[model samples]
Target chain A: MGLDPVKEEQNAALHKMRKRVIESIGRNMDLYGISLSTGHLYGLLFFADKPMTLDEMGSEMKMSKTSMSTGVRTLLDLKMVNKVWEKGSRKDLYEVEYDWYQTFTDFFDIKWRKSVEANILVLRKSMDEIDKIANEYAEDPEMTDMLQKDKAKLRDAYAYYEWLDRLIDTFENGDIYKLVPKEPPAKE
Target chain B: MGLDPVKEEQNAALHKMRKRVIESIGRNMDLYGISLSTGHLYGLLFFADKPMTLDEMGSEMKMSKTSMSTGVRTLLDLKMVNKVWEKGSRKDLYEVEYDWYQTFTDFFDIKWRKSVEANILVLRKSMDEIDKIANEYAEDPEMTDMLQKDKAKLRDAYAYYEWLDRLIDTFENGDIYKLVPKEPPAKE
Candidate 1:
C-alpha cells in the first residue's frame, strides 16, 4: 500500500513543531551542563510514541550507535530517561521523562546540589581555619580584627549556601510546585 | 620598610582562605557559562579590598594583561563587575559586586531569563503553527485529534515557561527575598 497524503501531511506538521521546540531545547541544554546533541536526542525521545532502542535512536538521530549509547547513558545518569524491558526484545529500550517539572527538578537536584555542597564544604573548612588563625593572633588587636572580618565574609557566604540547600530540598521534595504551581491558577 | 612578619602571616592566611573558595568558584563557573579562569578572576576581585586595574589583575592572576582585559569585559557585560573612576589613575579599575544575592539574581536574570524567553517565543510560534494545521484539518477527525494532542503538549510546555517567567520576575524584582530571605530569619 502507498503512503496516505493526509497522514504524511499530519506527520510533517507535527515534525515541524517538534523541530522548532527541540532547537530551543538543544540551545538551552548548555545551561544545564548538557551538550547540544544530547539535548536534541532527549527531545527526539521525548516526542516519540514509545521507548526506543539505541539502534532505533541512532537511526532517528543520524548518529552512530556508539554516540547514541553515550548520550543515553548521560540522560540515564541525569534521571532524564529510563531503561525499560520490552517483552521478546533482546535490545535495551529507553524512554524520556515527559514531565518537564520532574526533569527540571532532577537536573537541578543533581547538578546544582553537587556544586552547592562542594562550595559549602569549602566555606566551612575555610571558616574553621580562620577561627584557628584568629585564636592564634588573639593578642594582636589588628590581626584579630582582620581575621574577624574574613570570618564574617565566610559566614555570609555560608548563609547563602544554607538558603540554597533549602531551595534544593524544595525541588527534590516537590515543594517548588507549591510555590510555582505546575498549572496556572484559574482566571478570576 | 621591610615587611612586618605579623602582617605577612595575616596576608598569607587570608590568601589561603580565598584560594580555597576561589577554587570552588572556578570549578562551578561552567554552570553559569563562564570560563574557569574568568571565575577565578571574579573570585580574586571579590576578595580584593579595592578595585583592581588590568595590570594588577594580570599580575595577581599570572595572566597576560590582554586576557585579563577580555575577562574583565565579560564580567562587566554580565554586570558581575563594575569599572570605577580612580583619581589620578589613568588605568581603569574594576570591582566585583560583593553581594552574593545580587550576583545570583543578576546572573540568572540575564542567562535563565534569556533562555526562558527564547523558548517561550519558539513555543508560541510552534503552537500557532499547530493551530493553523488544526484549522485546515477541521473536517478530518483523525487529523484534528492528532493536531489537538500536539497543541495540548505545546500548551503544557507553555505553562511551565509561564511559571518560569514569574519565577524570573521574582528574582529580578527582589521578591525572591520575600520567599527565600537573603539572610535567614533570626533565631527565635
Candidate 2:
C-alpha cells in the first residue's frame, strides 16, 4: 500500500518536534552535572507511546550498544527509568518513571543530607577543641576573646548546615511548591 | 625570658586545635566541590588574630608560595577573604571577611538559581515543541494522549525549578535559619 502524503508529512513534523524535546532535556540535565545520554534516554522514553527496547533506543539515538546500556544503567540507578517486560517479546523494554520529581528529590536528599551531617560532626569536634583551649586560657582575657570569636563562627557554620537539613525536609514534603511565585514574570 | 611550662603546653594544644579546624574546613569544602587549599586558607584566616602576609601563611600552612598565592586568589575572588595593608609591612596581608555568611549565600544563590533558570528555559522550549506536535497529530487520539502526558511532565518540571528559585531566595534573605530547630539534637 502507498503511504498517504499528508500523514507522512505530519509524521515528519512530529519526529522533528520529539527530537527537539529530547535535546532540550539533555541540555538541561547537563546543567545539573547529569550526563547528556542519560538525559536524552529519559526524554525519549518519557514521550514514547510504548516501552522501547535497548536496541531500538540505540539505533534511534545513534549510540553504540555499550553506550546505550551504560546510560540505561545510570537512569535505572537514579530511579528515573525502569525496565519493562513486553508480552511475547523476550527483549527488555524501558520506560521513563512518572515520578521524576521524587527521583530528583531523593537523589539530592541523600547527597545534601549526608554532607550536612558530616559538617555537623566536624563542627562539634572543633567546638570541643575550642572549649578546651578556652579553659586553659581562662585567666588571659585577650586569648579568651579570640577563642570566643572563633567559637561564634563555628556556631554559625553549624546553624547553616542545620538549616539545610530542614530545607531539604520541606522540599521532600512537597510544601516548597506553595512557596514559589506562581505567575510568570510580567513581560514589558 | 624562659618559656613557662604551662603556657607552652597550652600553646601546643591551641596549635593542634587550629590545625584540626583547618582540616575540617578543607574536608567540608571538598564536599562542596571547592579546592582543599582554598578552604584551608579561608579557615586559617577565619581564626587568625590579625591579617597575615603570604610568607607567614605559606610557612605556617607548609604550602609552596605558588600554592599559597593561588588559594588566596581564589578566596579573594569568592569575596570570602580580603587583603589588608599592615603599617611598615610592604607585603599584602589577608583576613577572612566578616560577611562570610553573605559570601556563601551569594555563591550558592548564583550557582543554583542559574541552574534553575536554565532548566526553566529548557522546560519552556520543550513544552512549545510538544504543543506543535500535538497540533499536527490532532486527528490521532493516541498521539495526542502521549503528547498531553509529556506536556504535563514538562509543566511539573517547570514548577520544580520555580520552587528551587524561591528556596534560594529564602536562603539569601537569611530567613531559612528561623526554620531550623535551634536546639541541638539530644544524644541518646
Candidate 3:
C-alpha cells in the first residue's frame, strides 16, 4: 500500500475534529434561533482557508443546491457570509464575513427589535379594545375597575418590552462591547 | 328570543377583544420560547376576574382536559400560574401568579442560563477536538498555523457565550431593575 501510517492517522484526526466543530456549530445556531444548515455552512467556510462555490458546499455537506441556497441566503441577510465572483471563473464563491460581535449586535438590533415593536402594537390594540368596553360600562364602578386593572396589566407588559428594547440598545451601543477585551493588551 | 340586541353587541365586542389579547399572549410567549398553549392558558387567566378550574379553561379554550393540564403544568413550573383550593369548592382553581417583570427575569435566569451553559459545553468539546488535531499536525508549520487560527476562532466564540452569561447576570443583579421604575412616579 502507498499509504503512510502517520499521514493516514493525521488525516483521520483532522476529519474527526472538523465533524465535531461542524456539529457544534449546528447546535449553537439552533440555540440562536437559526437553522442548523445555515450554521453548518458558516462552519465550513470558517474552517476553510478559501471561499467555496455552491456546488462544492452541496457536495461536501450532502445537501441539495436548493437547500444550500436558502441557507446561504439567510446567512447573507444576517451579514455572516459574503459572496464573491472569481476574476476568471463563472461560479460564485461564499465565505464567512462577520465577526461574532457583529452577528450578536445585528441579531438583537433587527430581529429582537422587530419582535418588541410587534408586541407593543399588539398591547396597544388590546388596550384600545379594553378601553372601549370600559367606557361602555362607565356607570358600573366594579366593571370599570376590573377593566382598568386589566388595562394596567397590559400596559405593564408593554413597558417590559420597551425595557428589553432599551437593554438591547445599551448592550449594542454602550460599554459591554468595550468591556470585552477583543485584543490582548500590548506589551509595555 | 331571549337575546337582548344591545347586550349581544356588547358581548360580541368584548369577546373579540379578549380573543385579541389572548392571541397577543400566545405570540409573546413564542418569543420567550414557551409553548403557545401555555401562553393562551395564561392569557385566559390574566384577563379573568376570577380564578378558573381546569375544566373551565378546557371548555372556554375549546381544548381537551389533557392539553389544558399539560399547558397549565408548564405555567405552574414557570411559576406563572398558581393553584388555589377554594374554601368550599372541591375543585382546584388556577390564577395568574407573576408580574410581567418576574416572568421575564425568571425566563432569562433559568431558561436562558441553561441554554448558555449548554452552548459553553459544546464549544469546549469542539476546542478540545481542534486542539487534538493541532497537536497531531505540530510538525507542519502551515497546518499548525491554520489549526491555530481555527482554535482562536472557537475561543472567540466561547468568549462571546461567556459575555452573554455575564450580560444576563448584569440584567438580573445590576441597576437595570432599579433603573426601571416599577410604577410611575407620583406627581410632585
Candidate 4:
C-alpha cells in the first residue's frame, strides 16, 4: 500500500511522544542502578511494536551490536525483558516487560533482597562471634560491659535488617500491592 | 585513665565487628548511588562514639582529607549524616544519623521522589503535546485514533507515577512504617 500522509504524521507524533518519555526514563534509571544508555535501550524495546533482534536494536539505538547484546543481557537478567523464540527466526528476540509495577517489584526483589540477605548473614556471623568473645571474657567486668554494649547495638541493627527482610518479602510476595495498590486511583 | 589489657582487647573485638559490618555496607553502597568509600565513611561515623572532624575521619579511613570531605558532603546531602557544633571546638564535626529507618526514608524520599516527580512532569508535558497535535489534526480520524492510543499509554504511565508519588509521601510521612514497622517484632 502507498504511504498515507495522515498515517505518516501520526506515526511521527507517536514516535516523538515515546521518545520524550524514554529520555525521562533513561535519565532517572540511575536510581535503579542502570546506566542511561541501557535505560534507553530498554525504553526502545518497551515502545517497540514487536520483539527486537540485537541487530535491529543496535541500529535503532545507534549502538554497537555487542553493546546491545550486553544491555539486553542485563535487562534479561533483571527480568525487565524476556527472550522469546520467534518461529522461523534464527536470531534471538527480546521484548520488554510491559507491566511497570511488576518491573518495580522484580528489580527491587532481586537487588534489595540480595543486599538484605547478605547484610543479614554478616550480622548473624558478627553476632555469633560477639557471643563467643563475650562468654570468653565474662570474668573481666570491663570486657564484659564493652561486649554487652556492642552486642546490644548489633542486636538493634539486626532488628532493623529483620524488618527490611520482611519488607522485601512484601515486594517478592506481592503483599506490598495491598498497601500501595498497583493501579493508581481514577484521576479526579 | 590508663587502658587496661581487658579493656583493650574488648575494644579490639568491637572494632573488628564494626569493620566487618562497615565493609559490607561499603559493598552495598552502589545500590544507593554512593561510592563504597562513602558508605564506609558513613559506617565509620555510624559506629563512632562522637562526631568526628575531617582529619580524624581521614586518619581512621586512611583516606585523604579531601576525599573524606567530599564523602562527608555527599552523606550530608543525602541526610545520612549531620554537621554539629561542639562547644570550644573550632573544627567542623559530622555524625551519622543513627536511625536506620529514618535514613532509609530520607534516602529514598530524596532520590525516588525527585525521580518520580520528574517523570510525571515529562509525562504531563508529552501528553499535552499529544493533545495539541490531535486537535491540530482533528479532521484526520486515523491521526486522532493514534493520538488517543498514545495518550492512553501516557496516562497509564502517569497513573503509576502518581501512585509512586503517594508512596513517596508514605515514606516522608512515616506511613510506610505502619505497614513495615521500623522495629522488628519481639523475638520468641
Which model, 1 or 2, shows the larger DockQ?
1
Tens-digit lDDT string for candidate 1 (B16-117) = 777888889778877778899999998888766678899988987999999999999999888889999989999998998767777788888888889999
- Best-to-worst ranking by DockQ: 4, 1, 3, 2
Residue range A52-148, candidate 1, lDDT tens digits: 8999888878889999999999999999899988899999999988777888888878888899999999999999998887788889887777677
Cα distance off (Å), candidate 4, residue B32:
0.8
- For lDDT, the strongest prediction is 4
lDDT-based ranking: 4, 1, 3, 2
Model 1 has a DockQ score of 0.58
Q: Which ten-residue region of model 2 chain A has the weakest summed lDDT?
A: A1-10
Candidate 3 chain B worst ten-residue window by lDDT: B1-10
For candidate 2, write residues B1-188 as lDDT tens digits.
Answer: 00232543557766676677677767666544467777887787877767888887787678898888988887776667888987898899888786645766766675566667777786787789878878878888866876687688678777767756766786777655555334545669
Stretches off by above 4 angstroms in model 3 are A1-10, A84-89, A175-188, B1-10, B35-38, B76-93, B178-188
Model 1 residue B99 CA deviation in Å: 1.2
DockQ winner between 2 and 4, please give it.
4
Q: Per-residue lDDT tens digits of candidate 2, residues A31-150?
A: 334677778877777766578888988886788988888888887776678889879999888887776567667756755667678778878888998898899889998678767877
Each model's DockQ score: 0.58, 0.29, 0.34, 0.59
